[model samples]
Target: MTDGDARLTDICSGAAGGKMATIAEYYAGKNVLITGATGFMGKVLVEKLLRSCPEVKALYLLVRPKAGQSMQQRVSDMMTCKLFDRVREDNPDFHQKIIPISSELVQPGLAISPEDVEKLSGCINIVFHCAATIRFDEPLKHALQLNVIATQQLLSLAKQMHHLEAFIHISTAYANCNRKYIDEVIYPPPVEPKKLIDSLEWMDDGIVRDITPRLIGDRPNTYTYTKALAEFVVQQEQDKLNIGIIRPSIVGASWQEPFPGWIDNFNGPSGVFIAAGKGILRTMRANNDAVADLIPVDVVINLTLAAGWYTAVHRPKSALVYNCTTGGINPFHWGEIEHHVMSSFKRNPLEQAFRRPNANITSNYLINQYWILVSHKFPALIYDLFLRLSGQKPQMMRIFNRLHKAISLLEYFSSQDWEWNSENLSMLMSQLTPEDRKVGRPTKHAARLGQIFNILQLTYEPDC
Candidate 1:
């Protein structure tokens, strides 16, 4: 057999669970490189690595200065954040193992200096690429630059790493949203990514905007389109590198780790939940019966770390795609989420509520639109009028408008369900030792784990 065939066979075989190293042992003394160490999921990943894999040699975080804070300051601030409190208590000197490397994903060579690149290429044993613009309204040009171009650049840097054992790329499960049944394999991209890049290079913003609808076809937005393209881009390097792609669906707050319902940002359903809890979002376009594939942030990180270990140890000939999802196993619906969120918020009560938390999800287009006017816009109008009469800025209406736009972008996902075959995910779990599998279990250590597996252990068993 050819070398490529041999590698493919090895990946298909996976690792023997009985003889595999423990999660902590696999990570010991490894120099790990990570991008997006400052993101919501990235922060959790870093914290878990430090607290769980205490003996890891070092963590090289790629960061760029943002919001007036230097990269060092941002890293320092991140280490001190409440999320890392458990890790801090466990090892106050955890920060010593974290080394910040300056780099920008949007620029060529990821904007890394020659010396920094040389340093990374020498000692880095594994790479976790987690950075990408998750905004729905992001311009096509900017999205492609960060998601596709930057990924290609990172893969190039990975090639130069003499000691690189695995390169794990974080992708969205929605990347293949056009298909109802998504198998654990890279689907053909809508357009040749390079061709699309070449075509868009010369087009003016107006022209590009005009044609985006046609280019994306059945997909919802530039975010999913670019993510799909990015996956394809990552696949180009699988022949030479041991790579793993993690595609998580609807990442939610920690279920049991640092704390239950510990979420910092208002992205995705977080915003919807927070707004609904605040009694502001009363209605949203979502299918009541469709599966809500909510996977906890901690679960994704655990699976990612496990994938990293597997990819490094087994050296799979083909990159294994793990469809990290919850609906397939433990199905939850938007209707249930709406019910639970409303119940929880009403019980606990947000500081101030616009109205009682009574949010509803509906699939009917006209019904959703009607509720948007009655439950959302009308209240905002009244609130804005009240503010205007009080000689204050009429901000409620503006907030609703932005909220409307965000909801519109997200409705496509919530309104329908997709079937993702996560057999690869199960295989990875089987490779883990019982102790390794229990690392993120809530029983022994709530600080190190959240009740992630308790949810994922139940499988959806898709035929695909």
Candidate 2:
């Protein structure tokens, strides 16, 4: 076998045993405080921990009341989601261990009362910070407020936890989008996070919006810029806390735990896949060779949990960074993604699809615009014409236009490749037992397979 293959084999063997042992020791009586427990990744993290590490003492979730739902009600409803079905089946009373803390991260001191802070400081052993705004077009001030400032506040809180073993921060792999190669180590922030926060504090929304493009420079959106800043903020707490950062790229549906193809929101590539499958998206700008570094939620959570163990047990001198990605290790390109997505839709067509989910990813702007005019715009025009003739409203064109706008915003990510150095991820895998590796490997494989199957089955139906 090649050196890398031989190493993978050894690592897989070790993971099978070590993973369970680590879980047994680390979670036996430990309490974990998690933010963003309502988000996609955060939900999976909570589910996996409760299911696999049953002996974990307690889980304190930092939740904010949304709409009319109380924090406790939200947590209760969250437990009822299909994502936790497996966990529910495995441990029927898992919800009893979850403790919801009502606090808004964007507020000063995360809006936590001194009493709540004191209680957490004494009781919590680990903290998983997973909250952030993922909107590509989010306004600069709000993005920075939630992504960067909230992270700083959380770090300050983590430093107060007397029994804290590890503080794991979830970040996106696209944090450093300007670079082709992304390393596990944190890159110096473009501008100091604190300085940026202070400067933005005095500026109004319009002013911040006007300067965002110039400030971000080559990075595509505010999401990535603020994420990079958050990483730098987390690194600042390295001295007092056992900090670990997990950067996951394009999180998609669940792999194995709850069920395969269990996706809730229309964010990131999921939106693109769903829109295209429904025949709303017809043309997008993307390169065929660009690596679609889509990692499943479960895989990312698994790696995050593994990192938590390593950070707590080893307590490395520097903060541990895990580039939890599958692109380099199991490369898949956007072209293949397009092909599979199209095929999946064909087999299992969504209800009320606009037209057959036939689309192309192109690099040339003129060609893309041409296809948009001919294939997308023309079809909508003709369809609208027919609808008008039949005495119906012409809405198809408007819907296509909105989908076009959404796809345009996502094209940058689809047209590029990111090289993430995952040495720490490999190292963590090496520490797992052979059985644990066998279990975890299937989760990764199932996630990839599910994505491919969904893409092919949901995007390529004859009547889509």
Q: Compose the digit string of candidate 1's lDDT tens values, residues 1-464.
A: 44322322222232234566666778889999999998878888888788777889999999998878899998998887777877888898999999999988888889999999999999999999999999988889889999999999999999999999999999999999999999999998999998998999999999999998898898889999999999999999999899999999988777645545556577788778778878888888899899888777776788888899989999999989999887777677777767666766766777678888888888888988999899888988998999989999999888889888889988988999999998998888767654444332223233212333322221211110
Q: Of the candidates shown, which would achieve the greatest TM-score relative to the real structure?
A: 2
lDDT string for model 2 (1-464, tens) is 34323323332234334534455467778999999988877887888788667788999999999888899998998887766776788789998999999999889999998999999999999999999999889999999999999998898888888999999999988999899999999999999988898999999889998999999999999999999999999999899899999998887776544445566677778778778877877788999988888876766777788788878988999898888888877777888888888877888788898888887788788999998888788888999999999999999889887787788788889887889898888787667865455444444455468577445432211110
Go through the candidates in order and give each one's C-alpha lDDT: 0.81, 0.81
| Candidate 2 displacement at residue 324 in angstroms | 0.9
Candidate 2: Cα lDDT at 21 = 41
Candidate 1 lowest-lDDT run of ten:
455-464
- Candidate 2 local accuracy as lDDT? 0.81
TM-score of each: 0.90, 0.92
Clash number for each model: 4, 30
**Model 2 — TM-score against the truth?**
0.92
Residue 158 error, candidate 2, Å: 0.8
